[model samples]
Target: MAWEQVQKALKDHLGDSIYNLWIDPLECVSYRADEVRLACPDRFYRAHLDRNHLATVQQIVTELSGNDCKVILCDKETAILPAAQPKGQLRLPHIPERKSVVRALHPRYTFDAFMLGESNLLAQSACKSMINGDDTVGSCLYINSSTGLGKSHLTHAVAHALLADSPQTRLRYVTAQQFASEMVRSIQSRSMDTFKSVYHDHCDFLLVEDIHSLQGKKKTQEEMNELLDALIKSGKRVILTANNAPRDLKGIDNEFRSRMGAGLVTTIQAPDLATRYRIVEHKAVQSGLNLEEDVISYISQQIQGDVRRIESALLSLSAKATLAGGAVEMDMVRDVVAEIVGLSTNLTTTLIGEIISREFNVSYKDLQSRSRKKVISFPRQVAMYLGRKHTEESLGEIGKVFNRNHATVLHAVKVVSELCRCDTSVRRQMEILDRKMAEM
Candidate 1:
């Protein structure tokens, strides 16, 4: 039988925990009716298999291959660095040694601390179920969102939750860049086996952050593919976070992409206004800054669609208030926002929509509504086009304001751009809108 099939049967036979710790790391080197050779990463793995699981593994191989195949062990060449050093030495030069196995779990990123919103409700719920030990949630999950949308925060929360739930549960949380860097280091030191053992054998729950970082790295993607396959076959839990959906990742390996997609995929969308307000409030409270409702609302309005920026703004405001020895007020908040985000005025999609609606003699609600009437549609399209041109909001953000999709926003921009190029009247009107917005 194929190693993949053998891997599945072994998981069924040995169960998840046992198979993951012992048998999962073993790579089939060569197999025949009379003999089979398995590759182990290090002396420890070979010794463990030899002392405990050799007989069981041999029997399973015999049953699967339909012949009594002698299981022989071969240890792969190993060294974590360029040269073998003492046992307690650090392997990589740049990376500092940490006492904990799962590094990068921030102290503040706990489940209770995360502000639940419509954007991240389902993703948070799924993470919570896994944390609460719900087997129905499955062993693999993919959390995808753009930058500043709290993908990293949620993954760290998962780590904290798992550790809290079971103190002894083995886990390793690393970014895709870290994983890829380690793989490159392993290749340089000829310790690929040790790398495999570290991830596939030592880890029970692997939470890899920023997996989109592996998109263009060919060798790293291959290594990750193998590691993922081994972990999945052994029934180990793997949580991956990325900036984009699996299929949307450009230049990633096809097989690796498929493996990434073979799990529950959930996205954290951009938070709505109310959600942003809650986030600002939560972050302010965490920072020990008592923000008034108006300040919170102002911060939320200014730092829309990005939780990180909201927290940053709150932190800056808190620091400025502390320095001034006074309470935070609207002017102070405005100055801090200007310093942090470089704002000229309160320019937002809503303001842009209002301006365009008034100019075209249409209600702002009608412009934001689902009305496809030419009178309302032209102004709405103009609003979308100008929103994209003037603001830092994403196409999705502009679409949300106009009740349309990014594709629709792009179409609007294209249509408006063509109109500006061909028609002098439309060009002058667009110039007027631009000047008015700049003045605002």
Candidate 2:
């Protein structure tokens, strides 16, 4: 009861985001007159709370209890120790058991390494909720996204977190193709009972990637549907990833689609400009390349979708810089961008205007017109801003394309730049436009 009061106070004081991210995961093991004990998920979690939040927690507990209350923080494993035991006698932490994953997970795909952004925040948060064993997220989670947008990364992170927190957790991570192949092999060998038992009885957590691949396989779909029903009924956790939402998946039966969509379904869109910038910076640092801010900006702008492309471009730049025995420069970045993005070196103001017109649904004539309405002028400003960034055209030349003066072009650029900083909606629009142009 006292812990509930402390939780309320902490939520009110720290706000929902911070409280949910840091405090909500902690479990209150016991509360006595003079002492309160809380169990953290792991050592890393306990250490972070001890360093940053323990004092506040102690203060809050003391105030809530109307007495001097000592707050003890321990890992979940040690939470069962008797309160009379000395701190020195606490059990030593053990290494987390390695998970038996079907496919090897990338070493760097853990939660700490995933970049957070407006686009992928919900997907990441849902995955975290699953990891924390928060019941509110349901027993299943479906993540759908285009390639290279971090679905696999989040799934791998979930596996890492689940195994770390609960070593004996039966986690089976595999692609849909792998699942189907195993089923076929079992059928041929007359071991179908064993196959079904492994997924339905032995598994505690099931992670199947690219379920879209099972679109037309009727038997696999039926088997998967039955497996999902079994897992969900038994309260097992399931995470499924695909390139399309369940409703949009073709050749999948209504029953199977319904099962996939039964839980929280979240989509990860292309990262916005700010997210891409952070991704570029983080990857560059990991590669030990000292890229100038301008070079980073250029890469982030030129490469829009598919974070893997960013990594590839960085690798190419690093290799080129090493061969030349010099630091990375804008020219090297441009060549890499040109090679990977297939962007023509001759991007013109006219092409930029056309792309903006298509994106905003404003006619090219309206964009170049004297209209001052928000709809028309807003798109015009965005075009001018993009023109300056993507093209080597001078302000005067860009202005002529929009039927405006150099001063007007400069003002438009300034306004759009400020909007990109202060307005998320505008920043998202810019990112979409940037991706569209890059795809061209």
Candidate 3:
């Protein structure tokens, strides 16, 4: 009975193709005197419905009711549906089942939780469209932002939304290193076929965190290329996050770069003072701490780093106050992060070694104990390379950490440099490691 008159109007006016595609799928939600809320499953559907057929929809309603009536797409949100396919029906598709790298989904990344400021509207719509499965939008979604822009949260939100609606949807969220590590293990185990099947053929969607890590590794580039092409060809969606654009992913394949650029690209710009305050207040509320607006404003104004540090300062103040059984006042924030503002310090020797060990097979002990073997030295060279990249320490000081002269440190940098140009595997490893260190 809801759209009875409207239906008659539509039948009288629009042809069948436009009717079926545009109006057929819309579901009516609650309505008020001012608005008749209609919603399509995804934004693409909404855009299509609105673009080609809004006039017809409006005309139908106006004629049927003898007054103006309108339609609006429901929120671009998909409800998680039960995923149990009939026996033998939706059995896990033959995609690769690499060990999932989604350590945890952010509780705040859902549509209900995200602060819907105007800045992120386009991206939100794109995410909603991709989640809704219109297929017009390219599968490769690029979220560009500097540190602390909540890119990861948005990425996770898309992953959660899609898999929620279609539980049978094959989804894996991972950092680039984890992707490489899984691939490396697959190659080692001679189950590259399974890896290939799981990662490329079987995956319905892949949300890769920090794809800039793919910049250098030729092997990772090729492996990623094959996986991307497979997914792209099969109509699977991929979401990628990075600190910079595809062009900035040094050493990445031009073809892959071209493909990434083909999709929707959006950036999370640095938050304004108001946004930063909102972030502070949000973090403070989670900790059951409250600060005065003036104080929140001051703390937000003082900080210039990513969202990570802003939250950290909030937590630090809360912890300090909690230990003293006090409040997270502005004075407390000021006292805690005073030194953290506009200050960049050298990467400590220990942190540098751990980064090296994680990147290369070299042990932390080997980093300082003078290992010249290819395996050990390769990691050591990586450590030196990162040191040059991320610290105030001079090359001579870095040499001291490695028990080598400055010239040797320079050589290590050069050696990795030359290897990165030709060896895809080596390049991928270094890039991932470098990003890891930078994030830390």
lDDT of 1 at 84: 40
Q: What TM-score does candidate 1 reach?
A: 0.59
The window of 10 residues in a row where model 2 has the poorest summed lDDT is 90-99
Tens digits of lDDT, candidate 1, 342-370: 78456878767756765787866688788
Q: How do the residues 1-440 of candidate 2 rate in per-residue lDDT, one tens digit apiece?
A: 24665787677656799889889999988777777889999999999989987876775565344357799998998896446744553333453232344467888999999999878999999999887778988989999999999999999998888777876676888899989997897577454654665577557889999999998999999999999999998988899999999999999999999999999999999886567778999999999899887677667766877999999998999899999896777777888899998864356787677657656767777888889999999989999999998888999999999999999999999999999999999899898777756644
- What TM-scores do the predictions have? 0.59, 0.61, 0.54
How high is the CA lDDT of each candidate model?
Answer: 0.78, 0.83, 0.69
Error of 1 at 220 (Å): 1.5
Clashing residue pairs found in predicted model 2: none
Candidate 1, lDDT over the whole model: 0.78
lDDT score, residue 13, model 1?
62
The clash count of every prediction, one per candidate, is 0, 0, 14
